[model samples]
Target: MQEIKERFKELRKELKLNQSEFGKRLAVSKDVISNIEIGRVQPKTLLIDAICDTFKVNKDWLVNGSGNMFNDSKENVELEELLYKISKENSSLYPTVLKLSQLDSESLVLIDSLLDKILKK
Candidate 1:
């Protein structure tokens, strides 16, 4: 089993973020990040989520050290990070999208087509 220090070092480096900068994204102090990296602290669930999402880390791997650290490429990781941030602010978006999907095939296709068009432009 990897110690917290080794896991922390690998994760931060894989994300290409400095500890202080990563801490800022997770809304934690640098000292908190330092403590986690050096085995002085065990991060809570919320903090773990923040860190994992911000760095595109695999949650299971972080917790148990059993899988790849990151599951996405650099660009995809950044996009996922952005989406996670948006998720926090727009908690209703998922429910709204789900409701919209329950309408009809035509409505779903229309929405999907519209999104595709916008994405292509």
Candidate 2:
């Protein structure tokens, strides 16, 4: 559990997010993040799931520290961070990204095909 807490803080630092920013993404308070990081409070399963889902964290690595920290490449993580910023400002691209993220593999393949045709690429 202590190791998991440390990994939680490490993941936040790797994402270049402060406690408050990280908490905001997880819908938690900064104090909750602080307490968990300091081993003062045990992190709940729901909070863990939120962290993993929001940041694409590997649950195995977050809980047992066995695999890579992130399920996606660092580039994907950076893109997600950018999307978060865009969402805060209510950018048109934010909704597009949100919708794109929810698409299934088949839909994504269709979208890719359409994009390649439209772009002549």
Candidate 3:
């Protein structure tokens, strides 16, 4: 299992937040964050949930290191789940989705416009 203190430190660093700033986001004092990070005290469940939700962290990964570090937004998670199901049903589509995932936002917008035009025909 992942140590909460270690994961808290990692999350703080990843977000480029100092203890004070991180604590502000969680509505806690800097001392509280410092204490949690140092293993001086366990954070409350509300604090843990706040950390996960506010930072888009995977609760399982934060708690047990059992999955991806970040959780996608609801829309993204839904889309990904749909794609996974589709990919399983039609394996060839998986590569296309993989390639699409590599495209930057601008490129994706261009592709979307082109696809819209094609579909309109």
Best by lDDT: 2
| Candidate 2 residue-wise lDDT, 11-112, digit = tens | 999999999999988888999999999999989999999988888999999999888999999899999788878887877777688799999999999999
* Tens-digit lDDT string for candidate 3 (1-121): 5698999998888766799978987889999999988999998889989988777789988888778777976566446547756997899998899999999999999999999999999
Q: What shift in Å separates residue 3 of candidate 3 from its native position after superposition?
A: 1.2
In model 1, which runs have C-alpha deviations exceeding 4 angstroms? 78-121
Sort every candidate by TM-score, greatest first.
2, 1, 3
Winner on lDDT (1 vs 3) = 3
Question: What is the lDDT of every predicted structure here?
Answer: 0.79, 0.91, 0.83
Check candidate 2 and list the clashing pairs. none
Which parts of model 3 are misplaced by more than 4 Å? 73-121
Residue 100 displacement (Å), model 1: 22
Model 2 gets an lDDT of: 0.91
Clashes of each: 0, 0, 0
Q: What is the lDDT of residue 48 in candidate 3?
A: 84
Whole-model alpha-carbon lDDT for candidate 3 = 0.83
